[model samples]
Target: MILSSPDPAADPHVAAALLRLQRTSYAREAVLVGDERISPLLEDEIGLTAWRGRWLMAWDGVQLVGAIAWWETDDAVEIHRVMVSTSAMRRGIASTLLSRVLASASGRPVAAATGRANQPAVALYAKHGFRAESDEQIPPGIWITRFRHAA
Candidate 1:
């Protein structure tokens, strides 16, 4: 797999593909979390293009398979999204994307959140040295686990 930063302005197709992948990937998360209104699934391509994060896309010989988006702050990097195509799950793609993002963070803390019921995501973050710091409730019943990587 090849990883590259995609410029949405130069390639609108990347944003469209990312939106499709986000919906497809997050649908499973929605089921796991018992919430059909997870942010990724509710987002549209227009909103995706307007997002203020940089994306690292994973490609398997020209096919978009996964992506990780993040924004850098003064002292922390906030990971907005980490998505792998449903067909590409369990292939180490997400881990690879996360590794790249962490490397690019240049020692700043990294923060991310996942649905509380999304065990795979929680485990993935743990594997990368992130610790569960807190939990948040959105829409009343849905719980999200916030994680932070300080290394």
Candidate 2:
């Protein structure tokens, strides 16, 4: 696997490719959480291109297999998304992408949220030393757990 960082605004193809992977990956996440209205499921290429965050993309040969997006806040790295194609699951792509972000965090803590029912995601964060900090229920009773890794 290979990793790369590319600005979506600087490359329309990057935006489109990420959008495709994001949709499928989040679609699987939506199924895992029993919620079809997750934010990533609703994002489009325009939304992706408009995001002012950094991205780390993973490639298997020429295939775009995974991506993680995040931005730095004053005290932490706020991870917005960790996505891996359904066909590429269990290949350590998500872990690799997330580790890359954590490595570059520069002593800032890391924060992320995932559906409370998404066991794989919850376990993934736990394996990376992130602890569940809070559980928030959005409208329609969808619960999400926020995680934090202290600096």
Candidate 3:
């Protein structure tokens, strides 16, 4: 597997593929969380391109398998999204992408949020030294857990 930052504007095809993957990946999370209104599932290619962040993508040869997106603040990096294609789950793709994200943090803190009921995601973050700090309700009923990696 290869990891790289891809410019969506430079390749429309890749942008579309990533959008499709995001939708599919987030759809499963929606089910896990008992909500179909997650924001990632509603994003279009145009909106995705407009997001202000860096995307780290994992590829197996020419196939896109996983990706993580984040934006840096003065003291912390906020992970906006982490996804692996449905067919690519259980393959360490998400972990690899997240490892790259944490390594790029340069000692700054890193934080992310996932559905509170999404055990796989919660476990993944915990395994990487992130501690759950709180839980929040976004769409009124949907619960999300916030996690922060130790600095």
Candidate 4:
């Protein structure tokens, strides 16, 4: 399936879908993050405006199954979010989104981070050629693992 850019202006549905994706996906990470931050992180505005970076959404004939977004820094593209509908997990949605993003970032380094306990995300990054660069305690209680995709 082909990935498409989100049209926040034309589609109101994306706002809700992105909100739900954020809520559910981050719930798993809330153990590493407090409810205070996780709650706001699920807010729709953040996901709706995610297109300010590189956003890619996968559609299965009008139904949005997955989405991702990333920001390009001076030296690397930092993936900010990657989400697939619960029913769409393990079906290559994230992989397809990442592949599309990586293609756009061709010849440059790509990077991503996830909660240290989020093994699936770590595995996904590894599957796409990203190697773990650091695991650090960025906050009082949270451990974040940073990964970089070498060119």
Alpha-carbon local distance difference test for all models = 0.91, 0.90, 0.91, 0.76
Q: Give the per-residue lDDT digits (tens) of candidate 3, residues 4-96.
A: 898776789889889988998898899999999888988888999988699999988888889999999778899999999999999999999
Give the alpha carbon lDDT tens digit for every residue of 30-131 in model 2. 888888888898777888888999999998887899999999976779999999989999989888989889988978999999999999999999999999
lDDT of 3 at 90: 91
lDDT of 4: 0.76
Q: What lDDT tens digits, residue by residue, belong to model 4 across residues 70-119? A: 88976778888888877778988889899888888877898888877778
Q: Which stretches of candidate 2 lie over 4 Å from their true place?
A: none
lDDT for 15 in candidate 2 is: 83
Q: What's the TM for model 3?
A: 0.96
Candidate 1 per-residue lDDT, tens place, 21-45, comes to 8999999999999889888988887
- Arranged by lDDT with the best first, the candidates are 3, 1, 2, 4
Candidate 1 Cα RMSD (Å): 1.0
Residue ranges of candidate 3 with Cα displaced over 4 Å = none
What TM-score goes with each of the models? 0.96, 0.96, 0.96, 0.83
- Using lDDT as the yardstick, the better of models 3 and 4 is 3
Candidate 3 versus truth, CA RMSD in Å, comes to 0.9
Candidate 1 or 2, higher lDDT?
1
